[model samples]
Target: MSEITPDLVRHLGVLARIQLSDEEVERLTGQLDAIVDNIAKVSEVATPEVAATSHPIPLSNVFRSDVPGDMLSLDEVLQNAPDAADGRFRVTAILGEEQ
Candidate 1:
């Protein structure tokens, strides 16, 4: 079993830029020790034959086929625009720049 010392916890807190109280450090030591122990157990069970995976079940891309379709004309698209110029939609300059 791996042991988590108070000094190690204090170092981790300093590296993470967190101010941890003495009580918090003591409490976190036990929690981190338990976590490390559990990870060690998992490592014991994991073998070279067992492939590492991110998920328990298999996954595949679920995407539709990319087929070209008829597109709207410029006139049909610009009909609803509040402002249009040069066959395109025009809006007020947000950055106070001339169009």
Candidate 2:
């Protein structure tokens, strides 16, 4: 098993652009090491004969019928909007332009 050292944790933190203290790195390294060991144990028991199952129950295409029905008009759809402009709902610009 690959050892998760403080240096490895520090490198990961740098890649993710996160600031972490030495104490945090030590704590995280121990936790990550245990988790990796646990996953290794689980992988050892997995066999090719058994089909991989994501959930406890078998799931298939659970879908609803796509039947067209009477729909609301454009005006009716936008009627409940607090601020509507043209034919759609108006929202504030996320990026402010420089004056």
Best by lDDT: 1
Mark the 10 consecutive residues where model 1 has the least summed lDDT.
90-99
Local distance difference test scores for all models: 0.93, 0.91
Clashing pairs in model 1, backbone N/Cα/C closer than 3 A? none
Segments of candidate 2 deviating more than 4 angstroms: 61-99
After superposition, which runs of candidate 1 have C-alpha atoms over 4 Å from their true positions?
Answer: 97-99
Best by TM-score: 1
Rate residue 93 of model 1 by lDDT: 73
lDDT of 2 by residue, 1-99 (tens): 568888999999999999999899989999989998999888998889878889999888879889999999999999999999999899988886873
